[model samples]
Target: MSPSGNQDSAPEGVRLQKVLAAAGVASRRVCEQLIVEGRIRVNGAVVTELGTRIDPESDLVDVDGVAVQLDGTKRYIILNKPRGIVSTMKDEQGRPDLRRYTREWPERLFNVGRLDADTSGLLVLTNDGDLAHVLSHPSFGVTKVYIAKVEGRVSAQTIARLTAGVTLEDGPIAADKARLLSASGEGAGSLVELTLHSGRNRIVRRMMAEVGHPVVELVRRQFGPLHLGTLPVGKARELTKLERGALLTLSRRDAGDDRSAGDELSAGPRSQ
Candidate 1:
């Protein structure tokens, strides 16, 4: 039965959690939780043990009995998300989600981070889990540039308060950069650009609100080396090769190097 057979016969095996993650069923952490819950089955038998391996090509691996497929290609996309669309892939209330904005995108990519349903601008989507994880982590110190319209005139004192740091319900929060775009009138608001290294929930709004100038409108204009310059609202484009490389370099620098805490201090945004 074995006569000079050279064709490959080895079954390609991968960790059960990785298989579930690659299938977009859930994140690795959530997949581990699912495994602990005995919801994953391999070859018709429920398997709950962590680090369990399965052959993707031969074994009938399923999550809750639904068969899943492995993801072979890594996808990355830059989406110019418009207002009102939720950044998440799915909404439990059956509300319109980011998937609608990405219907034309070829691959099924998840957002790298998130912009609030009300917030809008450049959002990065990708199937590369590692990059997504790295980009979202605070250790990467990916600076996000946001242009905000505030309810009142942004004075030097307000900018000083932001740069000095303000205490929030969660903890003390500070802006890495803050500057007034222009002061309109006595009651009219001013446009300001604020940058921050941390991605706390609704941080810009909360910070400005704390300073007596609540954000009336907010738009994220940049992340790291990526900028939203001249890109019309609701229209997205792919990242340039150089931009991708620069982001990767920043990620590496942030991950492996340890600099003084003061080194992370960002300058206040200049008036433009």
Candidate 2:
């Protein structure tokens, strides 16, 4: 949608640079330079006019190629979930759930997908329903990276088996990538990382167990384009500008698949 809703022949909206700065794209002065250099796009059109105005409420903006969220009212959160916290907003069994983390935000934010009670790591919380669905649904090719501490030492053969695919009780599933991180000895515990796009219930644990090594503990380190960097456990924070851009880009890319089926985004290689 091009800039619109002129009031008495005037642009009647916020200045482009100001809107860009407000979106955390850059400082106001730098945003002006970006406008001059034509590094910005509004509604899929390159916008370089210094006097250009836009409706932040309706205009779709992007920096370089990444989509920028113009709505400040929406919340996109990254939570480093700790073990033993159920993924739901409320738990019927009275177990610890995600309600506490969401209580502080005024907007009703729900987790994009889930990390079971015993497993924890990065969980995205957002009020953007469209983007949430794109990130959560496995059909869109959104991948998740999990690091598992298993009961027995993992070997190259086991890693190959994971990538080669395994037959679970539900059906056949394969890891997008698998690697053995560490193994102390022949009988000691092992650290293995597996990347997968499947959303089957407790899939990581079930896959490891199917290979004769049950998961002792598991943590998701990556989800699609986002990663669980050094964020402390059980804490929630707003996504950084770059992080937010990458996530939104992934969502938009997947959303495009409907118009151009068979042109899905690559889930990357078979290694973590």
Please name the candidate that would achieve the greatest TM-score relative to the true structure.
Answer: 2
Q: In lDDT terms, how accurate is model 1?
A: 0.73
TM-score of each: 0.66, 0.88
lDDT of 2 by residue, 1-272 (tens): 24243445644568889898988888999999998898987655677788777778865678888889888888899999999999988889999999899888899989998998888899999999989999988899899999999987788999999999999989999999999989876567999999999988999999999998899889999999899899999999999888888988788778862222122113110110
Q: Write the per-residue lDDT of candidate 1 for residues 61-153, one digit (tens) a residue.
A: 556544454434655567778888888999998876877766776777888889988898889887766667778887777899999988877
Q: Which parts of model 2 have CA positions greater than 4 angstroms off?
A: 2-8, 257-272
lDDT of 2 at 80: 94
Question: Which candidate has the highest lDDT of all?
Answer: 2
Supply every candidate's count of residue pairs whose N, Cα or C atoms clash at under 3 angstroms. Answer: 0, 0
Q: Each candidate's lDDT (Cα)? A: 0.73, 0.84
